[model samples]
Target: EPIVEEMRRFLDKGMELQRLVPFAEVMAELAWLGEGDRDEALHLIALAEGLAPTRAVFGGLAAWRRLLSPESDPGETDGMAEPHRLQLIGDWRAAAALWARMGAPFERALALLQGDEAAQREALDIFEALGARPVAQHVRGLLRQSGVSGIARGPRQATRANQAGLTQRQMEVLQLIERGFSNKKIAAHMAISPKTVDHHVSAVLGKLEAVSRGEAAAAARASGLV
Candidate 1:
């Protein structure tokens, strides 16, 4: 059966999604599907309503869930307050404008999808420019439905992960990490210093939106990137 169909039945049955699991584990799995499961995602977000006082995974997930759901209130985003405020108020054009100024191509494109015709076209351009094939395809479908043809599809020169915003160097570092290489070994293999390898690892973590090397490696593998 379709996962979404199964999930709907499961939710309807009132089955305990967290049986024998902690709230964090449940939230972790749901976070990846938040876009498709906004109702449960909102429930999970409510479980951790207040942002944790520190840099914790639960807090991060909660904030991300809030951002994905327009029904939810504005949440912190490492300090992108005004754009989020505009988003909360349903002003995607204004929010996207701020996102562009903030150099957040992903969020900007997402906001543009919510905006007017010109904004949607700009979003499509940004998605194509970023080599984000999947998102670009979705936006293309939307544009085509709106009777837009002759849109430039730019060169889709990169891998499927261009949407991930990871640099090539970071991708290499992540590959080595998945092979169980430590910093020193990765540095030796890459012909770079250990400190540099550490930097690359950190960048991989940030780009993957992972909290640790292990989680980043798991995400890379899950995405079939290695």
Candidate 2:
């Protein structure tokens, strides 16, 4: 409880300063500490949001509460910020549950599409459990739009790429390039020369038949190479 008390003091100070970042950090610490004490956490989160209704604090507080109680109403908060936060943190189950609770078919479909297969299936299952057939059907439609036949059932198995294509070293270079890493950073990661990294990137681009590195990355992702 000392930590909570300390966090509260910090929260107050941050509010007095009208500084949102410190207040957001303290609210996050409080949420983490108040894991089993969800009612207290919710109260603290409400206070934090009331202090500065900024997107960061609102999203973080909503995410913490949704993680703690997924069946709570998603519309209790405004906008897509909280849902996106949950997705970014890989708390897809809770995100799905919140969407289900809100009974928003389009939002549920979007959540399922943005998540991995396991998460999509889990969201569908939750919708089914809620007896939300229309939502489930919407989700199925989204999957079909993405060229996927039905709800993603499980994780896709990794397959070995054609050895005749780019080598593992080339793939590494390609991934780094796509991530916008500079030659020096790529060299540090691969323990190679900047020149060598540049050469590998060129090779990857040529092999992928793409004009630009960005295009090559898009092609790779489309081909399920990355």
Candidate 3:
């Protein structure tokens, strides 16, 4: 927790200096990453805004609050920062792509949850793989609400229970391969990029100990994995 301690010190210093932007930034981080409640965070953010009402210093943080707060208006993302604006306004696919480019995997998956069924499933897979059970369950609930079928009804199984460790997306790729779909076809079917499909295919082959797609499919069938 050294990082948290350092951030606390930074927050204290920002407050001491009465620096509007830094104070707002630290308050926002503490609000999200610390035990600070939503109301408290908003109050602190408002205090920072009061310091400089005309500045757009806390637009991203405000947008983040709106995105995470169920009661907040979704269309209140005007003049916010790029990815946060996209997320707050429900432009999730664009938000997801931006998060990916920013190397933020969790945020990317979260943005994906607001997309279509295919994207939601991909987000579920990422959450499960990351051991984020709460968010994964939330995603499952979303899928169910959307009438998507064949969703898992419980927590992720232990790693030892599924020795291959293939993610949900990878399993889908394996099933498609078993049904004789090429990587390009699988990508088209899954609504993902061809490069992503290639990655999934490669992961499936590695997990199944197969040198070729056919071999992987056969092994999956024989192992009752498909």
> Model 3 RMSD to the real structure?
16.4
Which has the greatest lDDT? 3
Candidate 3 lDDT over residue span 17-77, tens digit each: 2454554454454344322344656766566555644334455555545534647654344
For all candidates in order, the CA lDDT equals 0.63, 0.58, 0.66
With a 3 Å backbone cut-off (N, CA, C), the pairs that clash in candidate 2 are none
Question: What is the lDDT for 4 in model 1?
Answer: 34
User: Quick one: best TM-score, which candidate?
Assistant: 3
Candidate 2 local lDDT, 105-143, one digit each (tens): 545544564577666666676665665543454455445
Error of 2 at 148 (Å): 27
Clash totals for all candidate models: 0, 0, 0
Query: Which pairs of residues clash in candidate 3, taking residues 3 or more apart in a chain or in different chains?
Result: none
- What's the alpha carbon RMSD for model 2? 15.4
Q: Could you tell me the TM-score of candidate 3? A: 0.45
The reply for model 3, stretches above 4 Å from the true place, is 1-36, 48-56, 71-79, 137-150, 153-226
